[model samples]
Target: MKRKINSFSRKITNNPNLPAAHAMLYATGMRESDFCKAQIGIVSNWYEGNPCNMHLDILGKKIKLSVINQKNLIGFQFTTIGVSDGITMGTPGMRFSLPSRELIADSIETVVEAHHYDGVIAIPGCDKNMPGVMISLLRLNRPSIIVYGGSISSGFYNEKKLDIVSSFEALGEKNTCKISEEEYKNIIKNSCPGPGSCGGMYTANTMASALEAMGMSLPYSSSSPSTSENKKKECKIVSTFIQKLLERKVKPKDIVTKTSIENGVKLAMCLGGSTNLILHFLAIAKSANVHFTLKDFQKISNQVPLIGNLKPSGIFLMEDIHKIGGTPVIIKYLLNQGILSGDCLTVTGETLHENMKKIPNINFNQKIIYPLNNPIKKNGHIRILYGNLSPEGSVAKITGKEGIFFRGEANVFDSEEDANKAILNHKIQTGEVIVIRYVGPIGGPGMPEMLKPTSYIMGSGLGKNVALITDGRFSGGSHGFVVGHITPEAQSGGLIAFVRNGDFIKIDAENNLLTLEVEEEEIQKRKKEWIPPLLKVKKGYLYKYIKTVSPASEGCVTDQF
Candidate 1:
């Protein structure tokens, strides 16, 4: 840690070009010695509101300590909005959730480009911020590093593991008279005990794991529990690792490649991550300017086995994954089995194969990560269905427990609120296909996730009997026979708009079909009668987002396709 004066510090250009810029920095008490050091930007998502990103400032401090105190580099921290999906779920407020990703990306790009920092580090939490930061890094194409905010430890109630999902479903159980109001209150009190991301393999944790698997993050850092010593150590470890990445001139474009995107999909499939991962990764690939397709995710899912035993689809939490050797063991086991490609270069400035060599071998006795031959499922947990309803495509999380196929009467709801009410009132029949629509990108104006509704059905003891399909997306914690992201979404005049309450709908996951079981003439007749909704957001971000955002099939991005 000796200050060699002009070693790495001299890398900064203190050229006598702009006196105002120099004066502004110096007026803040930046000494000449500090000016001589290389400048690094820390795009931090820190806020006092929610658990997901509350501790990001703490992580930023650790990162700055390494960059300035240990590596003799000047680090500047910038803050951005980190919207809480958990806080906004099931409300009109949720409409702003997905849109926050765009703002997060734009903010970083604006700051980093304006500052012209040599190296950048993004510390993110929650569903949107993680991918948002990565997209910004990809756009900048600078020497960059991404550190996940990490997972929250699980809470327990009556010796049973409880997390945010438990609280969400407990309400449904109370309404259905399955659980008493007293028990529901107990769940609300105990489900999420402290600060961290939602304690499940949901979007936040899913995107974190996906980023690690894709080589955007330092290996094993993504699994560290939030606010733990391990997480703080991870933040400190990153300063040195990122410096190496900077020294090697390794950009995000170098680390995030076509193969790497596939690797991300593989991890998502195995982990049964939120369907939002596909949307975020698609946006990430678009930002990186890599030619990745929605089908590409399906292709990788076909080969990758569902290995991680983490939930809302499984028993363990992400903290469980961290205890049993972190994400590297999952990568190493998959790579060893020839499922994941070892060729993708990672931020470690080495190939994924060499990176896997650093982590300890998977504990054979460990229950978190299972062996290849005896997987949680024979194939990956995710599936893509296409038929009359979703002509372009749709997504489904097919846990082996939900039989391969379902044929039931369609019970259509124009919105999630109606569907949610039906579950509580026992109005939704057991053999019914709940169809929630008009909530895609342009529809909901942000494509708010349907975690609440799906969790409600499961908690009401209708998970095995009922099937829910929507033009919206699902939270990673949403399990059961749920399908989402129906392409050419209902707002865009898709066939899902034509589904009537009494129509017989069938879902064949094994064959990848979501048929309406109606005649083509009927569909054509209904198409002629159908009229798209005229949404009036007046003048806000939603107004602009509605005008340009693409369909869910296209990642729900606002690019001018």
Candidate 2:
């Protein structure tokens, strides 16, 4: 029989496997006689190949020292894969990016749970890293802390800040010969200067903000630039925060309550954060057993308004948000507006209101974030619509600036590549609703974000006139009159697949609707010939994903129970 540890060291520690554990530690030169006191796992998603996470290696080293030298806890550092969405976009490699979220979550669970670590601190910089670590924390139900790797400062081109989105649009600009090859090369060199996730309110920053609002991270931890000394300070500060959490035995489930989840959505809408958050937030709530649905987002949206003046939807960078405080400015303003829940708890071991007492109210001079009463938009920034085209509903990310209603002839393409080709070849016409289908959770196998195509449309100077609709979702860097996350997706026989070229389609966000203005009998007739496409891969994880992953409406999660 394997021996189990007695309860002398603590209730959950100092196991009976003490003899073998001590022997292995002593052999490894970690010669603390009573070493099995407290173990805190420092999980990291660090890789040299991607700028989004390159800083984490250094961050992790500092945190490990703090954990052992200052806090007197034995810290074990481990790493996992971090696939860069920016590097992989518009290629077969992109298929692996979303799948990597699942792998990272599972890896955290496997490593931490297997060791029975008393607490865990996750430092993740890339897009999937935030939610993946949080999901594992929920499952472990241990004292956990999440520290974001931070955003990169905007690079400069044409005397303006250039980010990843600017670079993507520049490609289209070069394709159209509007910009000379020299200008294109200049943008390529100037758009990204150093380590960090792509700048603007892309997935990396959006989800990082979400994690903070969900109370999984320390306040003001999400908006600082990746390379700043402030980011270094934050890692050390959060290290101490985790020690405090371990003392109180507070946990993820205790903090990620229904109110906190709503708080996350409120920040997402107000910040004009990514639409990918819808799927990610749902997955997290499900993991925590929190009762969150699409209606909850809409209910909160009815109360909150668009305030984040940044990114693909707005005109500032995250570095700007950091200048006049950080994400907490928006969080505090929303909290005081009576639109947010004060009953919620955070990782700080206090109620939401208690924590809000420290953050100063929004500075009127701050243009990046406006006062709640004087929001940039009167309605929710992202509106969910349901109609003939998306019977289960679709997402429309509209700034108050973009017209809420659009009626145009359809320019249908079966895949993202096909639509991308049409746009590059000038086959796409003005006043057309470009329908790209068969790229849902199962169909695309990963439902890659349409930044490539959308950026192309904007670069080609048709952003104001043309619109695109897809069963897949969009990056936070994607804007214009685009509607995505069309449910009962193309592969599942949604009306989006039945859309033929030149067919009339309407996306009306004014009343929340996405409709195919075609005869009912004619739609039924097309449905008879509609067949789910064959799997691109014969086997492996993607094949398993097709069988197990649920719909986008259900958060695109693979695990059922």
Candidate 3:
């Protein structure tokens, strides 16, 4: 009889020695394109290859060439090995550029069963990978740890260090003023430097940081550069930690407790994390059967102060964060100030409180992480508002601007494309609330981040006195008074869909209100005749996504649960 080949057989045959291997599985969702794009070399070679090449230039040129240079050359042997490992490790999927959640979940299931793996390590970065991995882990309900692919190196455009957030904004600028093609290419090249973290405090980076803060990740793991010699060490550390977790029989449910979820939310707020986190975290919590909701975020945001001044929100980068003590330092400060749940257990086999003791001292003045007395922002990290425009509640960060909460006439853009065009034309006005509709989960179909246009608006000096409300998400680094993840999104006949240009909209951050100043009867009439935007995707993963994904307020997750 011919041997059968199925998901179960694949699981059993891959690793037959460890019967528990059937219970021990690891899965990682990465932007395979991004991973392939990462630069890798041996430790010594990488140090020697630094742009400055100071090590080579110093210690006398000949000695440098003989000792440093030659030693570095020998280390280059690992470069090919590293690159091959990266490629092979990421070669198991169909969709290379961007894999869907279902694809990731199915791949994870296959890998787990084949390896007879007991636990999983989800190496994910970028927007989709994190959520997909999280969903997969939730379904697997096994021991899991999320390892992020680190941020890309900051690029230079017109003599300025260009990060991913800025790169996207620069794309929308007038052609005459934008960076040259070569410069853009260089920017893309430098934008993603290594492996463990996302480029900026966008959804990817923010979510990773939030996970670390929540004690779901290894200590200092969130901030380590993917290309650093330390990354391999970190990966080994993660693998070892997972093994220990399994030995102890500790599962993801134990780590992702209510207190852990609350800590995650508080960290999200303190970092001024991506509006997407509001949805992603909620979904993760839901998968664990934890009762986390939008109101919980609002409640936490009301108290947690925005710190970590990086990216679109502030200067500095993830590398800078690592130098300034990373998430452990931040958690310690929150714990000292009674802002975080110090007793929560992390995957490190220590309570969050115990982890803080590992850090001898933290300097808030350095500004990598801020203290409660001298915070980056006065109020909580995020604010939740509701009104006739967003009956299901909308989320906004209150870290940057304070004047956007007052009533104003709405300036509606039917789609992100139109909004971009309007901004390019300099049609946006001060005191006008710019509303970008039809870009929510079912609307944008994937609820793509609208950080591009929002960044342009803020960078152009037009956003100083204006507010932006949208069904889309803003990067964690996006400051200013921006409200996002409005649900039911306009596409699903939410009140946001009924919003018209020149309509009076009120955004009261103080009382958590985002009401439209229209009569109930008129609102009802608009709803009756409201036509949902045409679906953005009609086939393939995008189609499945549009059909199965929930609204932004509901975490924009598919029906995997």
Query: Candidate 1 has which clashing residue pairs, if any?
Result: 9-37, 274-476
Tens-digit lDDT track of model 3 for 1-561: 022212222344344675553343222222222221111111111123222111212212222122212211110111000111112111222112122544555566555543334455555544545665666566666666665555555655557666655655554443335556676566656653433334556666777777888777787766766555455456545545654554465667888888898988787678767776877787788777898888888778777777767766777777777777666777777788888888887787778888888785678658666667777787675778887677788887776555536667899988777887787777888888889987776677666555556767765666667788898766554667788888788888888888889998877888888888889999899888877667766797667777777766777666645
* Model 3 worst lDDT window (10 residues): 74-83
Question: Given candidate 1, what's the lDDT at residue 269?
Answer: 81
Highest lDDT scorer: 1
Report the alpha-carbon TM-score of model 1 versus the true structure.
0.96
Q: Give lDDT per model, in order.
A: 0.84, 0.82, 0.62
Candidate 1 root-mean-square deviation in Å: 2.3
Worst 10 residues of 2 by lDDT: 1-10
> Candidate 3: which stretches are off by over 4 Å?
1-102, 113-115, 156-160, 171-198, 402-404
Model 1 lDDT per residue over 85-154, tens place: 8888898888888888988988998888777777788999888999889988988887788888888878
Off by over 4 Å in 1: 1-13
> Residue 531 CA error for candidate 2 (Å)?
2.9
Per-residue C-alpha lDDT of model 2 across residues 325-411, encoded as one tens digit per residue: 888877787778787787787888877778889898878786788777788997677888888887776888888666889999999
- Model 1 residue 112 CA deviation (Å) reads 0.6
> What does candidate 3 score in Cα RMSD to the true structure?
10.2
Candidate 2: C-alpha lDDT: 0.82
